[model samples]
Target chain A: MAPPSEEPTDGAVSPADYRTLCDLLRERTGLSFTEAKRYYVQRRLAERVEATRMPSVRDYLNLLRFQASGAEMQLLVNLMTVNETYFFREKYQLDCLVNGMLDEVVRHRRPGERVRLWSAGCATGEEPYSIAITLLERWPRVDEFQIELYASDIDSMALDRAREGVYGERSLQALPAELVERYFRPVAPGSWRIIDELRESVDFSLVNIVDPAQVRRFTGIDVVFCRNLLIYFDDLGRRNAAAMFHEALSPGGFVALGHSESMSRMSSLFVPRRFPDAILYQKPAEGAGA
Target chain B: MGLVKAGSKGTLGTAPTGAAAPEDWTALLEHADAGHRRHAAQALGDRPDAAATLAARLPREPDPAVREALLTALVRIGSPEAAAGLAPMLASEDAGLRNGALESLQQMPVDAVEPQMDALAGSDDSDLRIFAVLLAARLGPAERSARLHQALERDPHVNVGLTAAEAVAELGDPAALPALEAFAARFPDDPCVAYTVDAARRRFRGAS
Candidate 1:
């Protein structure tokens, strides 16, 4: 544990300090601060202040400025960003991703057609890699197709971990034994790292799901695995993101949402497709109108 | 020292004997440095006394690595005392600690945690609530089954509702069949809910 960089001369935290922290965070990560977030900011920053052995909040802010060049920034981002995930998380949705969606995309390919999958808000990279592994397992000639997986998260640190593709034993619990043996290598004492093949399959980048124009740039995606991530956003944000997915996807492309999330209330742009325990949506094919 | 040595794999005082009495386990703990603590703790291997000692030292350990070692030890030890030591850490300020503690508690035998299952079921924390549902499913008590049915109806978290539905299926209680049916009807597309409903129907039919 690092000591506080600087001790507060006054016991009270000032409003200016709070504002500065919020502004900095928003500028860097685009995470909006709610009225209730003041306490969360103070608590998280207090932990950092202690960890860095900084003398004061001002000094700590300065340290953050320099953190991009060091490990401190990475640690801070990792602590602040929420990586709520599990093995085979939202299993029903994954079933849809693996079952017919990939096959449909592959079948529709015109000579040099490429099947692309994007996992927006892919914390720690599990969702995208999970998709890749599923394709590799189910589709015999999957590698022959020009298959590309794009995984993105707003948090750079999370992207870093996703790129590294290492996970502990606990994360592997829900994964099947065969999948684990085939896709991962035992890296640390009790940790399993994703194989170089799987790691190379995914292209990790820092992307804010809320940005529409940026999303529109990645056109012709076959399937988008954006599961369990939209719950954090408000209704408007969710709708905008849904619309973005609607536009980014190729005709008849599929969208897999979190188990609890539905576009029923937000957008009728997608027609809901029912699987055994999962609900997904597909863009209407040619001659079909929403 | 004798207690620790008893728990450890290696023979005690093989090279040289010292003033360290077998009763002083602190020397054993001290010799068990950070890197080797996990292996040393594993040496305890399900002994109640060793688990209790490790539990006592876990809360105050400043090093996250050491705390993780102690947690792994407790999980392997798998005693009621180990569960008790880990319960409070479920609310640890550190996410890593909380994740570790919850995972350890999840691995404990459902029977050992049966007494506290109800409280966990009613917890505001979504993590604990889901864990309770899984535990109830494992234990299969009538009262827990009913509570889980109610949780399925009212739990805010969908995962909790899904887990509760699964627990009711495990209980195989006919009374829960209607609720499971309703849940399936409402979230007909949710595979987990469908699985639970199917399992409950099969179990209910078999029972009849």
Candidate 2:
């Protein structure tokens, strides 16, 4: 066998090396880079270096370039991505969902029209589960309604965990005692899992929010919860995502964003509406606000 | 007291009569096994304080699920004390705990939560910082508005900056209008910037 590839000596790994790594990551994963991310990359790759038994950073970089498989690529993506979320996160927005948006949807939905919701960037599944639980709580005969909940995240690991629907004591804390006891089952020491009833209500998939074509496939959705996540992107990314959400929603459907997110700068495609405590956007009643 | 005794029947332990017997309603919350905690928790709606007490006792419970239950109760209760109880957990080392605390705090009224708002605004964690900015927007007193201005100037996260800018605009402090205009100028291409600017302009026009 040929001699092993040369690895960069300790002192030789410089800012230039890091820049190359950043470029490669951006090229492959579409993650934007700012000065702040340098440290995160260094720290994450440092751990990977030790785990791979690579003698140096240069060798690791080469392996990543030439030998990385789909799984390895996914691992790299997951490591770099952050999935920070909680149940009923941004309650004001959920309030809009249960008290305002859902009520309106139920009222206008033609008899037998299946109401569907998509929670984009759902992060370990809290948003969608929250939606399902809210419906269950609000509608005494929820089974009589045709409701489909679709939850998607870019991270497969998060999707897998979300599918499990098992949360720790902390994840359940904000939940009302009744919902918790009713919806979850204790699995291990200090681990409570969402029951099949709630879990079954959601369909989890791995999806990138930046992918417009894939997003367009989801049409006629009654409501979309894409909260807090749009802040991560650059202007182009945000605009793309916003336009996609606009297209995905049925006319008169609502989109709830993170408190900080707004559509005013991106497009006139949505008409903003203010509820008691939250802001929502509606694809103006057919032929109206556009 | 009599209600407590009557409520305690069929519970794990017999309630001592006339001694403020454990609320029988409390027994309605006990699951046969930890496996049923979610169901029991859900059944205890409108009684979050009592449910919180029970949730705090489940040592063998899964930490995330139990925390979720406890947090649910706290938010539903919407009591000042419940909000206070969750304040410190915002700094928890466990991400889940910190997140749960932040979520619960978000549900509270801004006036009732002004005291703890500063700590969150000053947090190193981005989630806490963002939540604090939003919460601060709901608070009164010129000081809260001033603090939001400072946060807009100093926060490292762009999103935090945007939230602070929006909050300042909401306060309708004419003093904030120029700054909001300048901030909006920076993100000329940001869709959110237009909303922020429009809010500030509306406030400025209303004040005039």
Candidate 3:
């Protein structure tokens, strides 16, 4: 027996159908949409709806659910997502690294020890690449300690782009021309590819931080930069992600969240460390546990 | 030693084989390292059979992160058994555990938590009853207004009455006004009671 299709009244996505679709999107990806994005979502939704040759949005929903390859889902992710990913998105955090965190991180470290930094929700590698550039340009002790950088995003398409390491003018807006000249060479007129060495520095992977199977592997991290990502997570998801970061960090390791997001509000697992320049959260030393 | 691509996978410990047995994860719940224990609790959310074990560990678990994992796992299980496991933790003297249990209970369906609420409200401990009232308030007026109104009218503790009054104000249940007046007359000396009663009166009058 065939399922009857509920064609929307105006031959467009209905409010009920829009909510149902958005709920599915939120379930699969952490991204959410409010009524403000309805037009934008509807526009992209219309294209997919047309492209799939479904009679209506309801039928398209069935395709979205039963599609084994998840091809349509990827298209929706790429289209609906416009989260700003750019070099030096927040300069103060970089300043905190050079002036405060790195100095303190090295002071307690033995000679020639490896320092690991994990960047959760590093969308298309801009933030992690900027960190790499900061270490090379500003931190004089960059050569004294081994630095292992890992950046992860839940989006496979974004991870592919991150590995490619090419960016247009918008992604590099925060970067000074001199630094840009030093780090990247033009593959085209406006787009530039990160110099091979810098591109290879960050090992990018597809990771959803909430899933224990995916997140449990990260351990002994010295600093974690999970900026602007937890805002999408609900209470439980945020708590679990905080736990993952705490478990991953070495004793006394620091976590750098987005300027707007606070670790203290999300979980009591990490200790809040206030520096004159910036406040960061740290995994408490063994004697001190929150 | 400059920037090095240390590969994606960490070299710390061998990865556990595919789909660890529930018993394996349950044992890991007691692992000496809090991280492993935390991971174990999180992984056991997929195993309803381990809900009791997670609830049992909540009181004894020293690490906040691991205790959180236990609460989250129990919330995810969301069975009556899981709710039962969490209800006992509400009686804990440790504020963190009690609060954690409350927050987790709020995530459950009202039906799953209703039995636990009855038990907690009946507890001789004022703190436990307050916690139950807090859970009801968190669940909101639509789910447990009758219980809250009853608590306001009957519960002997001033704090419990205060919580119920606040719940009425916050939830804005006009039907709860008589209970609010009873509470107001019940505790005339406490200014907060009169203040809350006035607030609820204002909210109801405005709504009408």
Candidate 4:
């Protein structure tokens, strides 16, 4: 039977209803939305609207607001907060790593010691793989050190994809042709699977950044690239994660945050070290305090 | 060795199992390693009963990391007592500790923070009073307006009054027009206050 069309017949969410939704979303998550972002908001809301089989966005709003279980709210948040991660996303930090940071990192390392790099929220393999390829391709002495790369995400499904290490054009658009040819093999039209060597190079795991126990697994990491993820957290959540990162890092390790994020708000555990291209935070060398 | 595959050990370590008792965690709050002590604070934060212990350790905590862990734990607990514990840091002479406390308090919900507002408003320091108004404004609209109006009406410092006036104006309360006009009279010669009050008048009347 056809459903009754009692609501706004076109399934449009009124402006006031949209504002209420944005306000509720802002309260629950720290993310902000405005009229300029209505298209983005509505597109995601439409997916949930259809998935729930709700007649219109207004009723979907009721499901989001009044539902005691808050399950659908979580589903909406997951969708809304899904960042479109791509390879070499923000490469200046990578440049900083290759040119100067790597030299400084190896300065204190003993011969045959492993240097660990962690991708705290590596969604779909782009970030960690980018780092690996940059080291192999850019750093002149890349082969001299035994580098261990670790990538993790709270979402298991994302980790699964990262382990599979396959990508489409969206993820590969930033890679240089030679690097792409050297690293990836064509799986299909417009699809490439990272060569088995690179796939196995990064160890993908599921980790919730805020959970101390979960975050404690990797100690003595030399570099942590946690781009764009911490910005979603509230102040306390950010601080909690920062403290965890600080504890997990080795004495003189470095943290690279998203371009928009500053160490100032996160924690005072690390001192800001400015590289030629980007700013990074360095945990003090031993015998010093932040 | 080149980029090694998941080591002889598995890719990731086993999930962390077992939690320490609140007492165990609390005892370790004074651990020598800042990392150990920070973890203790994080563990106690999960215990709603440990708010006072976490709060008590906050002022004496010299390490910024440990102080952060303590403040985060209190924020996680979010009890009224936790709010009260964090409130005194508003009066701290140390900018880092005081600012950390303010940021942490801002993360708390209104109910958790409501009881402490009076103490903050009555603080001898005017900066604390201004911070109290800002904290009140972070509350839900109904409470935010009420507390901000209270500050506008009763605060002695011109700076506090001005901040309250601006915050109330932002709330766009219809009744705040007369309140703003009265506030302008209190600082008869101060152009900044006069300008702010005038601006708030237009906003309130326009909003109404």
All candidates: CA RMSD in angstroms?
Answer: 25.6, 24.6, 3.6, 5.9
| Each model's lDDT | 0.68, 0.66, 0.82, 0.82
Q: Considering just chain B, what TM-score does every model have?
A: 0.61, 0.56, 0.87, 0.85
The CAPRI category of model 4 is acceptable
lDDT of 1 by residue, B1-208 (tens): 1001110232111212242443444435556454344334434533567776787666666554356556656765667777777776766686656665766676566655667776777788987887777666655566566777777777777788887776666666788877777677777677777776787789889987
Weakest 10 consecutive residues of candidate 2 chain A by summed lDDT: A1-10
Off by over 4 Å in 4: A1-83, B6-19, B165-184, B188-208
In model 4 chain A, the worst 10-residue window by lDDT is A1-10
Colliding pairs, model 4: none
The second chain of candidate 1 has a TM-score of: 0.61
Query: lDDT by residue for model 1 over A156-207, one digit each (tens)?
Result: 8788889898999777888999999888899878799998877876777766
Better of 1 and 4 by TM-score: 4
Q: Which CAPRI tier for candidate 2?
A: incorrect
Work out candidate 4's RMSD over C-alphas: 5.9
What tens digits encode model 2's per-residue C-alpha lDDT throughout A213-247? 35645767778888877776654455446656765
> Per model, how much of the real contact set is kept?
0.00, 0.00, 0.62, 0.56
What are the runs in model 1 whose C-alpha is more than 4 Å off? A1-39, A48-78, A140-144, B1-208
Which ranges in model 2 have alpha carbons more than 4 Å from their true place?
A1-14, A17-30, A52-69, A139-144, B1-208
Q: State the weakest 10-residue window (summed lDDT) of model 1 chain A.
A: A1-10
Ranking by TM-score: 3, 4, 2, 1
| DockQ leader | 3
Assign candidate 3 its CAPRI class. medium
